[model samples]
Target: MVVARTRTTCVLGALLGGALLVSGCGDDSSDDAFSGQKADDIAAKAVAATDKASSVHMKGTAKVKGASTVGLDIRVDDQGNCTGTISGDGARAQLLRSKGGDVLIKGDRAFWTNSARAGGGDAKQGEQLAGKLAGKWVTAPADGPDAAFCDKKRFLASMDQDKTERQGMKRGTETEVDGEDALTLEKEQEGNRISMHVATEGEPYILKAATAGSEDSTMTFDDYGEKVKVQPPSQDEIVDPADTQA
Candidate 1:
């Protein structure tokens, strides 16, 4: 069963910053131009790249701390929904991808809603693991075509309006993410500093998000030219729909 084998063998179609400020006042126009490109523009590129990876099929492996600890094979469709199965220890559970932006896990019998209210309902062992995978969706670039970057766009827009460099600047470094070379973006703003490793893997862009302040999140994309696939989930093992919430 895929669910029982928890030593990290959940194979098959599986998945998948910073800054500070000080002193009184300052403004280096050159520095601002170099680094402070409108968050909208930069985010647009990211979102555009992401929007291109929609309605595609992909297979990979994933792992999350304090979570289910299994490998997965997941899939997503053009409508922005996902589904799949996870395997570990010969135990397998069905994973459902919802159009409403949440996941329902079978076998362990748990469901998670994409509520921004901080805490949802009961967290299952599998759900906890899935949380590590699903939670990253919230970080999608705002100002994109889908309005998916709702939270991020709002935050950056707020900063832009205040003219407050709450997020600090970065002298980025060239680094590798998910085996692809990318420019690691770093920033410290509004009491939150985060470093995001951006890269491309075929159609879906990969955004590995990590914060100096809290938990880390990862998002994979599958670009279909017009629409993009964001935060895709499992593909292979299909948990019984009846076992999940409707």
Candidate 2:
């Protein structure tokens, strides 16, 4: 859950900003299916479709408040299974969440060292913890703080509509996202420009959301309804925190 707050602000804010803007017509209109539709309507449809998705793969880069850019590549399902990699602050880790709510993380040396120091350990202790935990799958209980990153429910809830943010919105020129036909929606708020691309040929799911100015961010969504497959790490690869003195 390292980038959880940042992800919510960057990704969910893009979604809400795009959805909240007042509807307007675009400059050019072709015979595309969504050309005649209202921007708000299209945005609403996209939001609804995304809300109903059984699963999705999200990839993006966002700046954390006290950290440099963070990168995410996560595939998660409604059943709470997820697998992904998170990289930030010169550290990277692979994470897996089982359907039964278990979370396992295998991080590089830098990641372990950073975590150790962040938890108030001294340099020597950080290095020792890294030596023992680096590249080892560490199990986290379902109710633990680490499990917050694996909660698909919280992820989606961040995108829920916020009426107060609604302002002026307009449709942009039709575009393509990841080889799929999409309609662009644009909005601006507090010096930030927000854009959302919604698929036009299918279920109108939001394919991408981007924000620029002050803080730049981008999140893309795909693999709708795909199954999230994950398995717990073997005992040999797992490092229980209770067993570690660090």
Candidate 3:
């Protein structure tokens, strides 16, 4: 949220930050034999844990070819509900979908069409259409070509199954993220890399997955199991494509 003129500071993803520290205790997992686990086992376990969580808070930066870079902030619920904003290059868009698959898009005109069109990727085309779509809401189809980005739960839940894209995964380091005990696992293929920050102290959740120099973009995960409720915009605000003045 950006603060308008008056005098106030907006907040974005504020959280308690601290590394998970291991104290002297019976399990003393700091020295546990996790080192003996196979790379495949670790990778598989991380994937399994992430899938099981079925929900999370995600935020990150992703490079968009014609759009420069975009910042993504999203929350996904177990029932496949997702809500978030993707903003960059002076443009921003709000997106949401219910568990039933109805999609709603609000904000930047360029963003709405780019996401709602099956063949929409022309940068020039987006701007032109955006001019005509001011103050309009797009009710997109569930299976639209661009719906993938709007449906985080469905996309990420199957990340572990991308065996062909992930390779040579090896443990990197034992650390903490957002105050949780975490272990790093990394894999690279064809110059694309995915580094997973897997929680080690509890249920082995994939706390975060960061990708740099990849077509997939960089993203982070947190606040697993947090409730994320989305309310649809009011009816009159929606702009039917057929009824548009443009």
Candidate 4:
């Protein structure tokens, strides 16, 4: 049950507070309204900027509910390799060791060998269990600021499917995240509300996201549009001999 999660951007509450403040009036209302509107605009720009950059690099934490999620951390490479660890509860740790169909997930006690040739009850059981867990994962352009994930563009462009109305809150003014000025956008959907912070310098942009729905997940972006060094995974990181039978 290795859940294949499509990567997403960061939407920090702090950043969204400022951008969501522009849509109202009065001393506090005015401030809040302006923040919301500004955040929307900033997020859009950040997406555009991040799209334009040659690469991006980032890291963050995620908390998920409904499914088993204690803490999960992952990284993506421009060449299409997504690798990381999942630790908590009885499972301990799970590692993503490949891209797409070649993927592998190793739990602290056992591992999944994802080759098409592998077959068995444990394999099927592992896949089913992994699929039921809910948690957040981080993503950035594999190449740093100058590059972007090709699939990501399509995902963000399709925000209509999951659009939710925003909850009524006092939107804060635009603010800086880690150093970059960002605007945040907040909207409610289903039982959860999402806030996003967007910013950009040309194609190198930053977008952060936070959700308060059934699951709590937060993600951040850094050097999204700037090209940064990405190292190749060592051979050992790609496969586990213990999971493979000779």
Overall local distance difference test of candidate 4: 0.37
- Compared with the true structure, what per-residue lDDT tens digits does model 2 show for residues 103-206? 78788888877776666668888789889888888887766556545676666554553533333557776788889988777777668777878888869887
Question: Candidate 4 clash total?
Answer: 58
lDDT of 2: 0.67
The candidate maximizing lDDT is 2
Which digits, one per residue and each the tens of the lDDT, describe model 3 over residues 1-246?
Answer: 000011101111111011111001011123242556664566667666666785777777655333355566878776758798757545576778788476666666645445334233466655666676645666666666334445554545334333544445666778888888877766554565556676777676666666556344555678887788888778887766666534
Q: After superposition, how far is residue 136 of candidate 3 from its true place, in Å?
A: 2.5
Provide C-alpha RMSD values for all models, in order.
Answer: 12.6, 5.8, 10.5, 10.5
Tell me the tens digit of each residue's lDDT in model 1 across 37-84: 433334334434543444433333333344433334455554545555
Candidates ranked by TM-score: 2, 3, 4, 1
lDDT of 4 by residue, 23-78 (tens): 11112324432343444444444555554444444344444433333443444444
TM-scores of the candidates in the order shown: 0.38, 0.80, 0.71, 0.49
How accurate locally is residue 85 in candidate 3, as Cα lDDT from 0 to 100?
75
In candidate 4, where is summed lDDT lowest over 10 consecutive residues?
A: 13-22
TM-score of 3: 0.71
Per-residue lDDT value at 158 in model 1: 25
